[model samples]
Target chain A: AAADDLAFHEFEEAANLLAETPDAATTSQSDKLTSQEHVAVVVGSGIGYGAEGEEEDDKTSLLQDEKPQPRFWTFDYYQSFFDVDTSQVLDRIKGSLLPHPGHNFVRHHLRNRPDLYGPFWICATLAFVLAVTGNLTLVLAQRRDPSIHYSPQFHKVTIAGITIYCYAWLVPLALWGFLRWRQGTRERMGLYTFLETVCVYGYSLFVFIPTVVLWLIPVQWLQWLFGALALALSAAGLVFTLWPVVREDTRLVAAALLSIVVLLHALLALGCKLYFFQPLPLDHVVPAPQAIPPSPNVLLPSSVQPMTTF
Target chain B: AEAEDSPGEQEATSSKPLFAGLSDVSISQDIPIEGEITIPSGTRAQECDSSTLNESIRRTIMRDLKAVGRKFMHVLYPRKSNTLLRDWDLWGPLILCVSLALMLQKSSVEGKRDGGSPEFAEVFVIIWFGAVTITLNSKLLGGNISFFQSLCVLGYCVLPLNIAMLICRLLLLAGQGPINFMIRLFVVLVMFAWSVIASTAFLADCQPPNRKALAVYPVFLFYFVVSWMILTFTP
Candidate 1:
């Protein structure tokens, strides 16, 4: 009787400890033990655990055992018993113990390690500089110089128009940059690749624009053909590069169709211009300006003097 | 003895399942004796407290709302849905309508037709012109407009003309020629102004041409004037 009293006192103390503790493992183990004891009671009866006759007997026994197990036993039982919640606790522990999620893990690991981060930024900056400078040079070279001579006013207007038109092309490039930056995950690399392709092509459009405009002005077939071929190759390259990344069939199909149409239009325009308007010097129709006029007059002078000798 | 009796009251208190986690057997067997128990419906084991369930649901709703809010904010504030509309489909119809109106007037005058009365052919011509202009405009500028800007352009440009035309037609039915003509001219000028503003805005930032392209506004005005003369003077 004294031993039983001592056991009961120890059990009460354990129960108090469990209730006060916030650890998930202890609580989960207690639940598992309670469930196991209930199962044992049901199994102990003459009827099978699932048998209808055993259910009533099991219920009666469960009710009798409803008095909470001694706190210490409950805590010990819970701690010893493994169940669903145990798996959850294990998972949490495993996750916390392991490295963090992607990119974040790398970032955290490198937080104090500036040496590791430096190369990445340097490479990125170099790439950015190369891309920007190369594009700007390409754009400047493609622009028609206004100093050449014949239709000076027209040339000035053309230059102005082309400059203004370039703004629209910026939108697509900006969109590509934004998308690439936003979707940084490896799984989304295809999307980023696609955006990059778009950006490259969009910039290429600036080169293409001057060529197309020049072709249109002279209505030259060969220039048109050459332009068309360039366009087709660029488009095909873009599609091929992006095919791996873009998952949507509809978008792929649409892109293909658009490319085909553009190619065909370029081809047809070239053919007609070359075949129909043969040997016409495109430059002859619009003479190159002799020189770029001093800055364009802010307001057309009221005197109405013809500004050019042309 | 008292400790033993304690179990009895507990038994009374919890006649229900203590840990109802896997009570399918007990449910299927014990329920029928209560009276032809159809499968105990909608009985889920409640391991979590009500507060946890409520908190989870609240968190889920808040998460969804936050996501939706972020998307909405992007569209409204930063992305500028309005600009998208203006550059795309919205401007197309307005351009089409104006072009068609001008084209019809030109064709009618070229054909030497009396312009005093409205003819079905003239109406058809107007609509067809409108459609062509819409197509060309869309082709050129569709990528420029945001969805919201398209809506604004449609409201400011297309809707007013339609309303004015409808009102003019109604006035004509009451045999009010002067009033109808005045309304028509007012609507036309307003439409013309809208076109000028829109086109100027569009072209202002356009890249410089390889050659001096004709000033767009003047060209458009000239076309309109020629069409008006043909329609008004041809008999």
Candidate 2:
């Protein structure tokens, strides 16, 4: 009776331990059996167990015929039950212990995955190529020709124009295309990108319109108007794109003031040209040529004159 | 002992007279205001023929005196004044344009944020371009060279041009951040360098006489390439 009672207690403890364990596979199967029991029991417990007789009978008969199982035994049940060593079981439990919780998270996330090298390579390659080609062309040109010197004025204007245009137009389009390709859908363009495009194209207009208008139109006033418009638009575009990134407000205000000054200079230049460049009347500027120093004989009396010419 | 010490002290206190020995050797070195003092009748001025010798000596003395006076003047008025007097012609425009460029960059960047002005950058761009064009045209006309030759020659001018621009910017834009200054300088240098190089390469192989004409085109080519690159790459 004591042996039977101990065996029953052991089985009950084993079942409770299994139910409490949080292993995914064990919990799922156990939940499945419990739901099955509830459905069977709702109809009628005795009828449900009797109707599920074949499966239940096989499990029960197997358990009854088996020898009394040892408590806290090894999973190797086929071996002699008497040979179960408690020390070996304890050693196995100790062997499966885990480290502190936060340690593994750092190891998994931070230390692995060395995959950024490729992207860096691509960026470096592109930057180097562009820089080399651009710089080489400029250097070689200057070297071969003593005259083609890159003046500060030229450098400032061209660099500003080119840098602005690139930042405004090219980078955005490339970004947009990259995103479209990557996501397989169009994304709303960034604000800066739009501003950059406007600024670049607007500035280009500033360059082109004046060139065209000044060349094509004889009227200085119309050309001035076109030039003014171009300048305004270009400045507006630049400000729109750059203002967000600037840390100081004073500089922004100063830039606006400087623009006014530049416009004034332009106006002054135009005024000078208009005032000084009037068409000259030819007759007054070029006196008619007299006969080559009237021959020396012509100045003297005809009697003393040489016979060579009249 | 005290009397001897007194003499020694007096001797130490007073400096030896510099011309002491020459006092009795004057021999009428000073001219008389009246009729010149006569030597012996046999040794008359005409007999000695000393007028030419006197005139030459006077000239030598005058020249030496003038040279010494100049030396003293130079020592007294050294030429180290900090006035903006020298080379204002070159410096003024350079300083003005650089300050303007820096201001434009700053303003454009700011205006980009606050959404106020758009014309600031455009005006600067035009001014710079105008300056370049005027310089190129003037150099060409004055040098009696063709446009291409001007460009070829101008291509070599990029380095000095950038150095001047940088110096100007440094003087004018002193309060700005180092990083900002460096970046601006870098971009300017690269663009100028590249354009000048390309212009030179293109114009170098072009045939003589006209080869000089090809110089300016490199600058123009640099402008073209940089503009295209910026248009194509920047954003």
Candidate 3:
């Protein structure tokens, strides 16, 4: 009964909106932006709560009845995005971890309510984990042999934090902008909010958590195996989630976008593994030999003292 | 949607009367004050029995200590009850976090030649930082709980990890061996899972139905990181 009531109210509201602005249905993306109120309602109901809104007609008829108010720059407006619960988050994490062959994660799990919490904390956790584990691996290596001069590289924490955070946050922002720009030219392309894009990238890092632990093993092949596994899982999740959005573009553009995403992800995992977990340099392995006598050209303390006495 | 909105309305209505009743009681009780003024000796006798300064102080202290201890017991055997939530306190969590950090500090100092104070601070910061971030995440996820309640649960769940850290420290005394390392690994892994289970059990009810996995993942990660630290303690 409630769903029926909501649907009736949505139908009535959308009809009124269409009657008020007869040309809204036919406007381009640029004109849609100028018509902020119309776009806000459409985006809120059509994309924000799109789980049951499959058809374009149904989408236009649906409304985000849950939004208390639609005004941006209000705390309440932003609060709605944070208003998710545990099971949904866990489901999203699982979606990212195990990519279904044909399924789109954004459509399946996160279409209705994409969130920023996962993206922020997942990146933060990954950064700290990498830094700490990387240092621990170094310490373990140093312990295996006593001659190596090892110091705690505190800078790795800062560097890791910056690199991972920038990749997670800025890359998504840039991707969202690029997609939006492309969306203007190509009306057939699927629309994605910035939050969904960031959410996908954030959850993709989950595979790296266990992989870093595996990297602690000193074996070269095992470390590489862990890195490759992490790279493939993360990239697969990203590609599967994003393919629907990019598929409508030219084949060249679509392939370019996917390759860039996968390449960036691969680089993050491979770079961290190689830079943070590499073996000690050869110089650190063997100490300078202590038995060598002083060269004849070099004056010893005793020789200098005899000359001073004369 | 109406069903969801109804509870919120009910809560608002339910809270309204309690405030009205409080004011009503205060007004009605005022009449007794004048009556009591005429019977000062009797009132003084009642006050003597209830409000002797030292006795009241000791009683309050005992009550607080018992509250903290009961919370610890609940943490050890987490169940779907409101006891932890209703009377949430940070005393137990503070103690556990401090002790866990201390254990980490002692082990690292013994293992490394230059185990400075930063190691201790690092563990301390990581724990409190993780707890605060998780609590904030839960809040952002629209959890129907208070901030401190979430923090208390996350903190108390570290008890198992603290025990694991203690066990690892003892095993290290026997010298490093493959068998000892395996045993330590097993202990840390078991305790890590225990921490996750206990925390999720406490937190499961507060999370929204579809988003339970989201809230639980962070709890898992937080415990896993601590467990990793315990497992890798070389000394």
Candidate 4:
């Protein structure tokens, strides 16, 4: 399908097609960036997070290029995350265990500005625990079926490598981008703070910690059952943070968004577990209606045929 | 004790970022796009100058990657993309359309095996019809947006559908549950509203004030049909 869309019209040519819109020709404001300038100044200009609130201090590495390069992840580098006003990030940490960190996030940093330092570590920590649990999951699986020799697909080394990047950075970064995009979609423009969303997610992932106990159980169905329940707790945490932000303006919208957020949080957590941790021996992409027959309650259309499970 | 308490008490109006000289927003925002730099022909410099050029190139690539990431963000939120999109490229819309198509295809691969698969052609025809219908309606109602731009906006607006489709598909992994039904209901409903809000927001720049409501009806109906499909077709 994607190949076909590419055949139908290349995206760049489509750009050329619209490269001549009147709006394209003239952007006469200070922020209106020409094609070249867009690349040049986008870094210095804050498009999303507290664009006006922070100052830019260029890190001229060459001033001491000959000087001994400090080991990366040095204290100063870690300190950069807290360079911004952290009363909010601090408040979030204090309120982190609770359901609603958004209030502190909103009051301290506003909805737009969030300190990622604390949230980043919080997520990283959970990701570490998740990595450990993932290795344990294979062990438990093998224990259940002693007669069936199972060569573990995921060694500890590979699992560690993944969690190091995934939980610590990639997941958080993806959430940050998605949140920024969502806030941009909304009228507030800055309503859902970048750090606030990250903070919510960081804490939300905490649900994975207790859910790690799911690894102890060898029963496949039970592990999944526990996984869903565990992820639901994380989802609830996300909603708690999200609720206060949207509730005042639009109750229905807030409720609606909270549901999506919860669902997403749960899905992400579960998906990560299934993909990374639960190395189920039975590997097949069983499309719907193949594995499980439709329940008696499920009334199928006349055209649809139900198939039995494997 | 007094001095320590003083700093804590002075939290009144401190607007500076938490660390002094630490809140430089440019670093993470810089995405590395250029693998390396090519000096202009005949422009040769000493080793030192080249290193600085290398540093500059590195910084530029980072900024470029950030800029590209920002562009993608714009695709997700076209209303915000208004500025980033001036140098319109097919990347954003193509990404969005492909993502939606892939997600729908993934969700309904089962239906395909069983026949009645609304694969690429079916999905494209639906999107094309919806986008055109709204574009025509908008034009009649005095919207100034060009057809291609509407296609671009309308195409990107399906992002919410992609998300909703993912949620629905993921829920199917859990099999039939009464609670699953409710969760799907809530997800599709929000995504429906989100898709509508996004499309309407994108069209706001083009629609006339008096005729805006009329212009939005078809847009709403188009999305309503899409949302209805997402809701009814549970794989």
Q: Please provide, for model 4 over A1-310, each residue's C-alpha lDDT reduced to its tens digit, 9 standing for 90 to 100.
A: 9898874554444344324322222121221233443322322332232222222111111111312333556533322233232244445544543544444433333233344444444544454456446545644555555543333222332344465446545554665565556566576643554555555566555556666656565544465667767665556555655555565545665667667666555546545555545344324322222223432211112323222221
- lDDT by residue (B173-201, candidate 2, tens digit) is 45534465456555665655554553344
Q: Ranking under TM-score, best-scoring first? A: 3, 4, 1, 2
Candidate 3 on A1-310: residue-level lDDT in tens?
Answer: 9999987777666656555533234222222334445555664554333243355434433433322354787544555566555555677888888996677887877755677776777787888788788777766766775565455554566678898989998999989999999999999998788888888888889889888988887765566666777788889989988888899999999999999989888767756765666546333332122211321211122333111111
Question: What DockQ, on C-alphas, does every prediction get?
Answer: 0.01, 0.01, 0.18, 0.01
Distance from true location, Cα of B41 in model 2, Å: 82
Q: What ordering of candidates by lDDT runs from best to worst?
A: 3, 4, 1, 2
Query: Per-model C-alpha lDDT, please?
Result: 0.35, 0.34, 0.70, 0.51
Q: Give the candidate number with the greatest TM-score.
A: 3
Name the weakest run of 10 consecutive residues (lDDT summed) in model 2 chain A. A109-118
Candidate 4 docking classification: incorrect
Task: Report lDDT (Cα) of residue A100, candidate 3.
Answer: 69
Docking class of 1: incorrect
Interface RMSD of each: 31.3, 36.4, 8.1, 21.7
Q: Which whole-number lDDT from 0 to 100 does residue A269 have in model 2? A: 27
Q: Could you tell me how far off, in angstroms, the CA of residue B121 lies in candidate 2 after the best superposition?
A: 37
What TM-score fits each model? 0.20, 0.17, 0.64, 0.32
lDDT of 4 by residue, B19-134 (tens): 33333433444666331221222323432233334456677666656765675466456564464324444445566566655665634455555432245555566667667766
Model 1 Cα shift for residue A144 (angstroms)? 26
Name the DockQ score for candidate 3.
0.18
lDDT for A36 (candidate 4) = 41
Looking at model 3 chain B, report the run of 10 residues with the lowest lDDT sum: B34-43
- Residue A126 local lDDT, model 1: 25
